[model samples]
Target chain A: MIEAAKTIPVVRGAFREYYFKQARAVEEPGKIEQREFGYAQFGQAGMTRHLSFNSIKELHAMLVKEVPSDVYCSNAYYKFPTQPMQEKQWLGADLIFDIDGKDLDLPCVPSHTYPVCTNCGHALPPSDEKKEYSCPSCNGKKAERVSIPCSKCIEGSKKEVRRLIEFLTTDLGMQRDNIYVYFSGNNGFHIHIGDSEYVPLDPQARSDIVGYLSGTGLLAESVGVRKGREGNMSFIKFPRGGIAYGWRGRIADKLKIDGSSIIKLKHIVDQKGGYAGFKSELDKMTREMGVRIDPQVTTDVHRIFRMPGTLNSKSGLAKTRCADLESFNPFNDACLLGGNKVNVRVKTHVKLKLKGEAFNISKESAELPAFAAVYLICKGLAEAM
Target chain B: MPVQLMTSNLSSIRMGTGDLAKYPFLNEAGEYLRESGFGWEELDRPDMKDIIDRAAERIEVGVGGNIYDKLEKYEIEILTFIVSLIMVKSIGMEPVLKKYALSEARRAEEFLTQDLKQQSEMQKHSLFAKIFEDLFKLKIEVAEDGRLFKVRVADYLARSSHFHEQEWKLINRLVQGGHVYLDADETVRLVRNELSVLIYEKVKAMTLPTLPQAIKVKAEELRAKLAPRYEYRTSAVTEYPPCVKHAIEVMSKGENLPHSARVMLATYMLAVGKPVDEIVMMFQNAPDFNEKITRYQVEHLAGMKGSRTKYSVPSCEKLRNENLCFATEECNGIINPVQFGRKRK
Candidate 1:
């Protein structure tokens, strides 16, 4: 049975130096984290426990010392008048939306979710549980999520960032200055819409915002009116009267008064078969606009996020900030480690899009940048020497 | 006659520090508010002055927080109207007066539409829908689950009460579809909008409260008639009872009506001989419209299916309980639409 220890061997040795070297503490960490609590997942094993620290320094020291593979803080702030965070005195949390790559439909990207047996290291298909899943190797416990990275889906993830940014800025009217886009170290992006403007937004309000951006219960007629012309010809106009701002204004903008765009808007309103074309466009829009946000992150007020500067053990990269956003490339920009090469014996033909170059890597000993080498090792694709 | 609201009388408006109990809003909360049983009624206006002054002070000293957390749903609706009043009366405060005001306005509208749809779902809701039915004198057959079928006004009642069967049926159909569709004196093609406009229209049209003197100075910029209101499409030249007309306005905006209002509307449509499928088609835009169930129900009411028993419209007394009884020259000993035109032999 391959029962690896909770902490990864060499990876922890490498990550300890990276995490402990830098300090990434949030403002007022004591008040917010003390109430909501936080967690740390070391190496392969899950989080240690729900714990809180006295100051940012305590949290920072733990991160530097432990160098856990993953770290998380509660989204909500807690009340501590008499009782602790475990008690039911949650105040609320800032609204945050997270878009992950696993939710996207990347062409030709294969994914698997299999559990590895602790007894014998035998990973089996979960659907065949009644048969071979009895740990045919050593009668070990069932598998948990390995959360391996899917390297092929990186392109699809970059597109998702574009969709979310457009929706947030154009549709939601979120201030560009207030929006912060971060490459979440591994397989996705995290948008931190901070400030008092969104602080008091309740779960219900957050749900509404999510639903609208995701195209859940959208209506066609509400967006525009089809003005009749000769022989079933029609065009859209601003809602019979002047366009009301906010919801109505947004709808009008989408279904504009342009002549060519009118037919596209009208097919649904007039119950015409031409809606199929519009539907296809909408489907594409859904793919582009569909935000795979972690619901709990936005709803919970006392949630702790990964400190921006910490190295994510999953990909061995820091949760880097998009400084230019338009031109920021995660490969080179997030390469905080020394640019020296490390020899890694990759186990799979892992295709990587990094440093603006495509690398069709097979199971061979190759020297890559230190950050890329760690990426392969952390994604379970290679072993470091 | 359409109520011609005047704005030349700003000095005549009430300026006392009042609570939401007096509004345009609290009454509509109906049973939902009472059952929640949290003493919402006991709460007075949460120092609107402090909020405004606080926002002003914050603007001066740079503070960060939302006052929205302090208020409940009903209170938010009233706050929106109050902020709208301030927006209408003041120009200088406009730049700094937004933020919470805009959000509250949007929330108020959201609650209005939701409150209407939730009326039957909840134990208690406003009887405004019932009021429209009674005022228009529409006879509707109500099923056990509150589904309206065989909607019609008796010939005599339509004649005696002077209720237009076609026009009222149109309005009733709109209500049944969970919309506030009213035919008013204005003219336009169609108004693709929401229910929030109705709150503004109904409140401003019927009850324009004078701003409190302390706040009046900030609100002098907006003339009375130019205040924010829901968008609507008129395109009609028919006379309707003001209350009935109001129903049409709401439906035109495509806002959903309460459950009781739907029953009254369904029965009214059936009585008028509208095709069952056409009747069902009218409700396609309704949030909960089901093609199969709606079709079965409509066909059953038309006597084309079900027990084949033609349902009758509700009587005037039943309509009165819904707050639909807005009687005018049509008021006689007439109990139903059929008795409206019938003479005493």
Candidate 2:
């Protein structure tokens, strides 16, 4: 009976280890205990009495001649093919050059201010007011004047800036603090990444990070890891072996034919590289021979992420920032890339304390916090720190 | 002889010559009779009788023949015709007749008189002809009332008993008074109240007997038959002990029994020292036992603690065996300490 057992090509060792751990945890009184080596040892114990025959031919003969009560069992694994690679850069790059006026000196005063209205058109007094500057002429009944460039000057530049920001932060996984946004002096904005640590990742790693940002990576692997069943969930390990083993166990249970009988039939093969490659071969064999192997196999390999605080881990960072690239425009002098048009007509008042002296910075300051603020904002990093 | 013939012709001519010439007195008699109400009883009055008699006498004198005999023999008919003609004329038949009347006064007069008599006879015949007509109308009204009554009764009875047309008709007849008889609305109210009472009584009387009445009765007889040698246990040992016989009866009767009854029986049997294997075997032999036992096991294991569900029974059993009782683990975990204290005591 042991000699009659069939050999199936699958990553049986890896899956057995995983399933054994799960089965042990659930073993308790008044519950069905998981069988240990039950699939391999069932034939030797003569428990096969419940089963009518050792082979498909014998089973078929029993079914024809006898009461048709014999149960046949067999197991197979599940596997599917991995997608073929197509060469394309997962990372994107965008370069913006200043074409307006002569470049300013290093550490130049970042003062570029325009006074219009924080709300609607009504010239405000030079006094440094609160964050919300209301129109004094209308007594807050009408809108205050906003300081934005005329619409004709900056139309499409802000969108380009926004796209660049999304590609860097959400796609490239670069921290917003690592990004530097600056005005091009004439039209558009330049997004500079001085950090070099993020540049040399492999395509797979880049794709994985992209997948994490888009929230569409390996869900099964993460769940398996959280479940704490070894080999069930792993970022680096192949899952096809375990999936195939589970399929084999299910098929054996369903068919009621022992694995030995399958081995005697000489239909099983020990395919290398786990059960991942066995799925298509098994399907072809089943289709041509009009007989299906009990267990199916899955071959697809996927990359999983170990992001902090996700998948049973504690202390996951919960928040990130996004740059408002819709405000970036390039056609107008006040416009930056990604449709960010400087509000030339709107005035933002800031009080800068420099050298123990408070400078009431109004719309007259040439250096506003637009570049610094935008860089920090786009990378989903903290601002003003 | 020729002279006599000429005189007769002249007399006839004088009698029928003009409106005033032929029976001129008829206009006056007609005017007198027209003032009287035309009811049949009015014809018997002395004044009408006298005018009619005088009219006959004048006709007799004018015609120089037995005109009075003719009038007397057919006076009722003639008078009725004349009254009817006058009534018809008053109601606007005279203008129509006048327009069609012949220019010959004697012939026109004779024709009008004969036509009036015929019209009067036709009216009498018509009254007798349609005597059964009103009977059909009355029957139709009664039938319509019966239909409405039936609908009301049917609606009322349907609320409690199965709706049957014959039963509704019977009830309708049994009840008296139009409001009660055809009182479909009131009947519905009564039916609902009666059904409510019936249902309440049935539910209130429901109980879980340890031994079913049928089995107890049979057991007594069997014990009596064996009384000389052995005695049988007639009472149940467990509170709300399950009665398998009674359960079968309930199920057969098509009534949904409370699930507690089955659980009570199973638990009681188990408490009384029935082995699990024996219980399983017993269930296997029982009708529809597989379904019942499977449901019982699943529910007993899965149901909330203290719930009347089958799952609750197992939890209770577990506690009973351990002699450690607790409402639930979530109740501050007090049961563990209580059990420990009990053990210490």
Candidate 3:
């Protein structure tokens, strides 16, 4: 909980200032009146949702007046936006995919995260090596981990975003312009597909799409390596042309062989214990190739998604869209705070680079830029002086 | 006889008379009836006796879980199918309507499989595309080998939602360039349930005139056989444990439940001696419930399929570990949910 008496006002004032000046940066979603809106205020426990807005101006007015810690809009459209869920009469929803850096298997994770025992409050020194740590002092099994994402973590997430976009375009045949990418204002990226064809899909259909993207249940026979009817004979059957299409094409490309070289493909499978061994190889290939995504976010039609231009309460950064992802940097571009300096008392040793400046502060009272002060304050690492 | 369909692209095509006879539920078949000036009054004429007899036989065989005979004359085949639909509507029993639809769909599927196998490449291509689009609004394309069919990812997802097997999952299938590849048998099977649903909807919406005397007698006889049997074995809803009640509530809203919750509910229902069909009916409202798969799974849990090992309800401690326990203060403590109301009963 934020100490409501002390840091809440300071953080709220900063967020209020940003909204007053930059509310125009918020993009207006299509069919505004049909979408539900939600806002969470500072020091509040739950969100106030089932609200509707007719235009961006009305939404901006609320942002400036309420100074909410977070703002959200529904991905689904409804005939009556403010009605109860059962009566919402849902028409359709834009398909959404979320990729968070915290969920990835990054080797640099231990460098940014440290574990503390929940039972006895024992803290462990952070290290670069990857392993599960038990509490040394209390010998308790329960531990709470604290993570502060760095630039490398953000890059790791961006790599996943790139791979996902490639699959959306080349494999799914979604148009380039229809796929929108945004910095989630924290540690991840949010992809919104604007294609109307995808909007009306139900939860079951979206689960299948999720299965396809995540490569959950891929079968060995799909790529044409099957066991023969007679004794122990397994062979490779490719499409007629030496060049196959779809997953067959992908397998051919991975093996660097066309369909004409069935002999070579069979030889490769035989090297790994025939068809059964080749199945594992195919599984490994799909695991390596498939993109990581949060399945629940895509499948839930009733979700209230974070608005694009709203400030994320976790990092005090703006969730902004990337027109050109290659050149976009979240630290400089999405940092919405002005140059006014603020005084804060640091709670712990912290080091980070933001908006072309570096800070390495440790157990000291210091005057810092407003953006940096809000960042640390939001993270509970500092209190207003 | 090959049923030829003509189309250059995704547009609807002209289906032949033979096609109409094989798939009498098609919208074009309805159009063919209107064009031939057939009306409800024609059913009262003396010459319509053969059509009425065939319609009655259709329902009898449908309820017996067998496909009806195909008449030699194409016109009679089409007309008899129309009369069978009317007889089913006159009975107005939901279960019987579903059974009749399923049997008809099965018959059409058999003919469809033969047609897909025997037709030339060009003719088969258009027929496949036309039938899927007309019935389910699905888009299909021919694969490179000319032996398999491909459907758009969106179309395949909507059509295959009810399949529970790991092999039927979209990820497990051969997907390339946004289309899933399926052989002729697999492709036809994808639409079988949907075809049944289509026929069911049509029959349920009809306002049929009074059935002729012969047809009314057959409808009465079928109703006596097919109306839901008394549900005496099933316990009242109020006596169920809180966790079981929660599962039923979730399913009633067509909501998704955790896998453990589903297992707990299915096992508890089976342990209480609920019929497999009744257990299946309880899950009918779930968004992804497919009858064939649901029946197979329920029977499997009942120890009727594969290994014959009946599953017991999880204990309270197990449910608590799985976060499924919904205990309340009822002045009694029990180890398992099944034991909660047992002694009182």
Give the winner by TM-score.
3
Superposed Cα deviation of residue B225, candidate 1 (Å): 45
Question: Lowest-lDDT window of 10 residues in candidate 3 chain B?
Answer: B1-10
Q: State the DockQ of every prediction.
A: 0.02, 0.00, 0.27
Each model's fraction of native contacts = 0.00, 0.00, 0.51
For all predicted structures, in order, the TM-scores are: 0.46, 0.13, 0.77
Top model number, DockQ: 3
The parts of candidate 3 lying over 4 Å away from their true place are A114-144, A227-243, A255-281, B1-15, B34-50, B63-66, B69-71, B113-135, B141-150, B174-176, B181-188, B226-345
Candidate lDDT (C-alpha), each: 0.48, 0.28, 0.79
TM-score of 1: 0.46
Ranking by TM-score: 3, 1, 2
True contacts kept of 1: 0.00
Give i-RMS (Å) per prediction. Answer: 17.4, 37.6, 5.8
Worst 10 residues of 3 chain A by lDDT: A239-248
For all predictions, the C-alpha RMSD in Å is: 22.7, 45.3, 10.4
